[model samples]
Target: MGLLCYGSVGGVMASLILVFSVMWVGGVGGVGFHERGSVMKWSGIPTALSLFAFCYSGHSVYPTIYASMADKTKFSRVLFVSFAVCTINYGVMAVVGYLMFGQATKSQVTLNLPVENMSSKIAIYTTLINPLAKYALIITPLVNAIEEWLQVSKSRFIGILIRTVILISTVIIALTVPYFGYVVALTGSFLSSSATMVLPSLCYLKIFKSSRRWGLELVMILAILVVGVFIAVIGTYVSMKQIVSSL
Candidate 1:
């Protein structure tokens, strides 16, 4: 956000958002698409599914955003719309990007873009400023929760101290981790799966008190919970092994 204070980062981001699809498509065309005629490894399915879980993990922010919405009843509608948009955007990017680069794709797709291409430069520039914009939003909830639990003062000094400490701790951890992408994938696999899929189902099962234990609805939810836990445990182990090997 500091960049927004002194530069046209917001405008640039807006422009990028507006043209991102077009640019992705055009850039894919310009760079050329190739088919490897190869199959994805079965061993990679867990990590791939975990990454998809991360993509759908916007549910974590729903409570905060919903609280700020003017029409509370319309929250479900807003969620549907948001996810629909995201599905389209992510689907297009995934399909086009994969078709364009195939198995050669990197964790950050833009990094796979041709170095000489303007599209690549724009992608790199957008990426540079994205973290600045995302940092506050990502950390604010955790900070607020911690402050509330500790009954910390709402004063600016206390707030700044808390945010700074949290930021520094995360930065330190990130610096220590050699493969940032693997760490993200691991987190998404373990934490995001529970947050996005398991908890919600369990919460619903508990809150509604469904009497039919053998009913299809209950059975499906039970299956989801089991699968979620399985994925979390297995995925974390796999990701940790990969991270260790990288080191």
Candidate 2:
């Protein structure tokens, strides 16, 4: 199920890239699709690169991958290979996309992607091929939460009910929220800072007695936390500006 979900995400990303390429070739341009009042202001390329780095921040699955492996030494080897492939692919795409669309790459890429507009035939086919994929994406975390709360008393029926309620609540909130990016940025700020930076370093420092090595790791972690906080602030401010402008 996890593998299938990963495959679907990869497919979606590939399809979006293809769509971006098409739009670039078709000469579409501009940041018109971004929410109103989004500031284009930035210090320089360094800031632009920092924002671009956020897209690569979803490396949380690395621990799961490492846990699944039988041989621990293979972890570094696997990571190196995987990182190389991802870096090459992302770098090539970014360069090609930038050259093709220049400053409009991000907007063009987001606007041209049309997964929501999938044809009925394709949607039906995907439903048949991966019947549980979409439901699992929405429901799995809810199920886990229910299991945590109910302990051994939780049943499949209970899980399903919990999942349904959560799904409904999410849909309602999504509908009510005027700007999703704002919600995303605010939530992401909290999650990214703690998960990516703060908590990990704390865990390592407390659990591992390797003081010298852990000190360096703590430094790196603090750096990440600082940057994460900065980005989150900027994202939240921009989102608020957008909301105010719309009103």
Candidate 3:
């Protein structure tokens, strides 16, 4: 995890491994058209929308990546490259998984892979590594935010404590949540959607109020804000309904 977070090489290698493993599963399969299902269930729309929002919710770590860059001017390039790679990875995985299992596809693509296949094992192993590799990136910003809120900067130990506390709380939530699908949908709808889509647009408008307040950018951002809110509201309703129904 440390090596992956602190070094460029590790991230690249891990990403390549992920991409290859996923593609390998697809390549070895001759999934029937039955697997490539023709119908979509209307009930799954909210879950699908929320999960897509979750997939792209990396905005929290953008500032850290930007500040750490040696050449800040290339930050745009970095974003372009990162988004491109993510798009490819996500696109391929979605296509392959749908082709393989269609409506039956699990959130963990490896779960849909044939358990007897070597490619399935590799993909599953790679999935385990991915969260560990990204743990630092995921936690750093949150830790910083907490520390800043408390104005506790003098002690690195305090930051570690905060991280530990947060991790422990997360574990408790995981154990108590009862269902992973509910958790994912709820987080994506409320937290990820707000952070990734709603907050940024509002912040941009607020910050640039004296500048391009009424330009083409405003129109685009407003459109995004509306769509984001709609997703958040409908997704949250569906997710909450599922959770209550299960209970």
Candidate 4:
């Protein structure tokens, strides 16, 4: 829908749709986690890290969004606002969802809802449709990049072919893996750490080369990179191990 409509307006509508859907999740009151399973364990660290990385993985599209912005200099402010909104939304969902399902929460929270209920039915349909609505918007950059690389931007036939191939490939991968949580963890661990954590810090250091060498900022940036690399390595190992075992 966003791709069919104006990009900016469609984006807003998509976001609004999500906001309304989330309200239903919280409004359908939850049973507290009384007599529930254990709340914390040391074994959850890697999965927790993977989820955090996934939440912050929007950086891959920052360049495209910045290019579309009217004022590039205000991009940082816009990005900050975006992250803040996402953080609040995720926080609320996390609390409400955990309260509702406790230890039994599914990878996709919608799965936890009662399928027979009307509201759950609505949510399930909306959730299913939401991805289709945003699919074009999400893949436009990749498709354009491929067209540009192949110098086929003017060839409508080639453009369609490229998109079709990419879509088919994506479906094949999804079908092959079939495990939602494992795929999320694998992607977040293998790719998102570099995009969301390491590269930004390294870019900052490079851009601000005039700053005092061996300063606190440099140390902190290096530390961030190190931590990112550590997480990526460990998280990928964990995810791969889990994937292999599931096979």
TM-score top scorer: 3
Better of 1 and 2 by lDDT: 1
- Evaluated at residue 227, the lDDT of candidate 3 is 75
TM-scores for every predicted model = 0.83, 0.59, 0.86, 0.84
Report lDDT (CA) for all predictions: 0.72, 0.53, 0.77, 0.73
Q: Candidate 4 — which pairs collide? A: none
Give the residue spans of candidate 4 off by over 4 A. 1-39
lDDT of 3 by residue, 75-132 (tens): 8998898889888877876776687677787657676777777766776776677666
lDDT tens string, model 4, 124-196? 7766666666567677778878889999999999999999999999889867766688779878888899788
- Which digits, one per residue and each the tens of the lDDT, describe model 2 over residues 97-175? 5544455544334343334443323433433444243445435544665678888344778766776787789779867
Q: What is the C-alpha RMSD of each candidate to the true structure, in Å?
A: 3.9, 6.8, 2.8, 3.1
lDDT of 1 by residue, 1-247 (tens): 2332234335335434634733554556376555454566788877877777777776645666667666789988977876786677677767666767788877777767766766667766767666666566556667778889888857778889998999899889978766766887798888999997889887887888863467888888888888788768888888888888887
How many residue pairs clash in model 4? 0
Q: Which ten residues in a row have the lowest lDDT in candidate 2?
A: 29-38
Candidates 2 and 4: which is better by TM-score? 4
